[model samples]
Target chain A: MKMKCTISYDGHLFNGYQVQPGKRTVQAELEKALAILHKSEDKVPVISSGRTDSGVHAAGQVIHFDTPLSIPAERWPYALNALLPGDIAVKTAEHADDGFHARFSAIKKEYRYFVYTEKHPDVFKRHYAYHFSYRLNVQKMREASEHLIGTHDFTSFCSANTEVRDKVRTIYELDWTDTDDGLQMRIVGSGFLYNMVRIIAGTLLDVGTGKFSADDVKGMLDAKDREAAGRTAPGHGLYLWHVYYDN
Target chain B: MKMKCTISYDGHLFNGYQVQPGKRTVQAELEKALAILHKSEDKVPVISSGRTDSGVHAAGQVIHFDTPLSIPAERWPYALNALLPGDIAVKTAEHADDGFHARFSAIKKEYRYFVYTEKHPDVFKRHYAYHFSYRLNVQKMREASEHLIGTHDFTSFCSANTEVRDKVRTIYELDWTDTDDGLQMRIVGSGFLYNMVRIIAGTLLDVGTGKFSADDVKGMLDAKDREAAGRTAPGHGLYLWHVYYDN
Candidate 1:
């Protein structure tokens, strides 16, 4: 049976969504739990919608896995949750069509970056938000965000060592608003290259700080060079808010 | 100068209030920070109104420190906050009369404990709440709270390891209220011995669960033995709500 699972996780303790040696990764933890249920070391290969870096949390990370054991879809969430760690939770699980792939079938993904401009450190909110005591001009950041929308070669806004040849990606939406805790920057795109969302967030922050004009993003995009992008924001502030898939 | 400081801290990372060797205690952290400020090998001891256990948190824990430094007492909050770690912050600092003391001059201390009765684990709230899936009777808990008013020899409620010779402590008020998030137990007392608040909370929880009657608390208090009290609740769900002091 092929199962589609929606999960939420606190990424601070994890190396990343991907499994790596000597580090406690989210995939490895989930895989270990799945192995216990199936009674086989290689019973399932869990596939996620995308790789989220360490300290990048998720509210809804879509994933899929195949199992030889027969288990009701309704019981999947409860069964998996019992074996998973405290930081991760299986929110929903159901049977997906045979052709569906958690990654390839996705049409769009939404990411949110949270930042707070407060002098005192928020004791309860430190894990979920990045504190930037410096005052920011949101109007300028919004102006810069407009230039980031639409289809363009985002090579300038990606990590230098990214292997993807197609640097072109369509950003469906880019907006920023003041939330109760801090400023929340939301970006929805068909696909993203390595560090694209974080780079965009950093660039917007630069604009907000008046370090660069909104037009600078245009020049950076025109250059199509990784060095042209702003500094990458720390992964802790980023969240995989949601995933959109074609019906 | 006598300085009054309001400290906010995440208690999960420390071993309760008092300074102890080989342990990371809140008092030790503050003393270390104060030592750095004073440029003295000798630690600056700060007296706190509330001495909470490990894993408990405080949004505002009142404390007083005496120092010969010429800095105004009003600047103590900002100055201490600048030197403290990210986990601890001094919210406000004020000058207190020489007669003022955080512990002896305190009139009342309020504590709040949160419990979640839902089946699902709240990832965001895991550190601050105790999760139990059982159905709780709030009315029963509230009714039971009435038995815990005024002064009493709380030997049954206090832990055996406490160094305090007298078991008599006045609990001014104790009540339970249901919130959108969970059940909140609030207790106001002149002072609390080791594990007294947690034991009271545990006893009230027992009443909520129909294991004991509200009137049974009378017998428990009369017993004056630690074994007669209900189990001690975990420390994570408790918070030092507020402290009132007389100048």
Candidate 2:
């Protein structure tokens, strides 16, 4: 049976979500927990809604793992959390239809990037946020984000190593808000390529810093080349906020 | 010449305040920053008020580094912070009397340990605090802290490997308070042996959990055996809050 789970994890310790032989990854951790719980040496395959890079955190990372245990779905979260480390926690768990796949079934994904621009670095939130010394123009960044909405070729913002042939993807919404903590950039999209969100964040940061304008983003989108965009932002600031799947 | 400086550090990235070969430490980083500013590799020797374990944090950690840069003492914090990494910052710097030393001139040291006594863990504060799932009796902990006040032989609460023969120490204050964030334990002492604060925290935690009585602390103190005390608390939750040096 397919068991779907909503997980929250501190990605700073892992290379990424993907399982590697020697590295400590989130998937590997989950599989280890499952193996221990089920008393089986065979590894259980778990699928995530998205692949997050190293240092990228998640509050609503969705995943699914198939298990032979006939345990009730509601008990999964408490059971999993009991075995997982303090860094990872399962907020909710439920059984899904056999056809449900965490990644391919997702209709939309929302991501948020946090930046701390305060003069004094936060003693508590140093790891969970990105500290930028210079002030940023939220209005300018919002203006640039408009050019990012809608279906278009995101090649300029995508990682060069992305194997996806079609560079086109739909961005349903783009929002920016500044709070007491820092500037928050929230982007919702139907799909995102490798390093796509971070590059877009970097480009928007360029606009916020007055180095570029909204038109520059449009120009880069038209160019459809990775070199046309700004540098990729640090992964630590970005988070996989939510995932939407059509029933 | 003694240059008295107030230093601030994240402390998560460092092994401790002391300098050790092949390890990145707070004192080592400060010395490196001074070396760059002074244009010589081994010119500055850094000394700190106390040594904090790896994963421990500090805000008003005092240190002194001698330099011949001729920079005004008041401007030293600004000068050194610019040269240091994001994790470490110099809060204040001042010239001191010839015999003034950060470690030797210290009269009292204050430390704080943050505990999150919740059913689940806080993702952002995972590294910043110790998460105790069981309920902690704050009143009980505070009541027990009263027993720890004043001068006493704290041999039971000292680390087993401590080299200091003198087990007698004066605890100026010991208290616990409940905050919106979590529980905080504050301790001030004239001087502490190795792992003394952590051991005290551990013993107090046992009192909080109803495992030990407030009056039991006196017997433990009188026993002078390490086995009479509670388990040693993890180092990550401890923070060297500040050090007082008699001017």
Candidate 3:
């Protein structure tokens, strides 16, 4: 039977979401646990909605796999949690249709980024937020984000190493809000290229610092060059918040 | 010159607050940083408001030390923070009277505890909160807490290994509130014995679970026996929130 599961992870514990030679990863850990449960020598493959970079957390990452066990829906989380590490947890699990694919079937994705604007570092939240310490003009950042809210060629906002030839993507929503400590940004889009969110976040931060303007952002999009964008933000401050799909 | 400083730490990185031979402790780290700054072979002692056990965090732990270098008050924090580890930070620094002492000058202390009530563990907050899935009666816990307030012999709530002979202390206030992720507790008192706050939190949790009644808590205080109370809660969930003094 086909099984679907949603999981959350601290992200600091793994090298990244993909399997690598000798390095520990989220996929390797999940596959090991599943293989151990199956009592098989062959590796069990697990498909995820997408790959998150090193130190990039996930609140609602979905996956799908095949399992022969007849465990109830309520007991599925418990069964896997017993074997999983403390920094990872299976939030929910259920039987899924045989036709569904975790990555290809997803309609939209939401990501959140955190920036700490304090002059001094915070001991508790240091791991979760990037300490920028710059005087940011949030209003200017909001203006810059508005220019990139619709479908556009995001080549300037993606990593140069990306293999995806099509650079056009639709951004449904882009917003920034003040938190107790700093600023939080939530962006929803149909699909994202490699390092797309982080590059856009960095560009917005540059706009906040008056290094760029709203019109400059539109120019960068028009430039369609990766060098036109600012540096990529660190992965620790990013979170894959959720994924949307049509049933 | 006597220097008074306010600092915060992520306690999981240390063995405990006090300096111990061959153990990484908060006091040892502070003295090491100070001695390095002074470029002296002798250790510089740091007297804290009080000692916290291993894995217990601090938000506003005050300390006092004598320094020969006449650095300005505003620059003291930067100088010390540059030498301190990432898990610790100096929040503030100031010149202090020669007679002032961090331990004896402190008149009151506040503590906060966190309990995650969800049955499933939270991956992000695993290091900072205790997970207890049992159904809790918050009203009963509140009633039990009221009976514990005011001046009383806290022998039953203190650790059996405590060296302090006098266990009499006054609790000024106690409160519990719901947070987005879990339950939070705030407690203020004249002083606290070793493990006093954690033990009381554990006892209150027992009351929430119907293992003991509010009247039974009163009886436990009357008994004045260490074995009369519930087990001590883990140190990771407790934080030394603040210390108050008459300047």
Q: Which candidate should be chosen as best, given DockQ against the real structure?
A: 3
Docking quality level of the chain pair in candidate 1: medium
Clashes of each: 0, 0, 0
Best of the two (1, 2) by TM-score: 1
As for DockQ, the candidate ahead, 1 or 2, is 1
- Model 3 spans with C-alpha error above 4 angstroms: none
The models' CA-based lDDT, in order, is 0.88, 0.86, 0.91
What TM-score, computed on C-alpha atoms, does each candidate reach? 0.87, 0.79, 0.97
CA shift of A105, model 1, Å: 2.0
Candidate 3 lDDT tens digits, A1-247: 8888889888987898989889979998899888888888988899999999999999899989988889887788888888888888899998889998889889999999999997667888777878888999999999999999999999999999978999999999999998786899999999999999999998899999999997899999999999998889988899999988787
Native-to-model Cα distance after best TM-score fit, residue A19 in candidate 2, in Å: 4.5
The local lDDT score (0 to 100) that residue B100 gets in candidate 3 is: 93
Q: What TM-score quantifies how close candidate 1 is to the native fold?
A: 0.87
| Model 3 TM-score, all chains together | 0.97
Local accuracy of candidate 2 as per-residue lDDT tens digits, B1-247: 5688876777777887788899998888888888888889564888888788888888788987666678887777777777888788776778888888889999999999988886656676777788887788888888888888999998998889978898899999888888988989989999888899998998899988999998898889889999999988987788888899887
Tens digits of lDDT, candidate 2, A169-223? 9999998889988888899999899999999988898888888998899999999
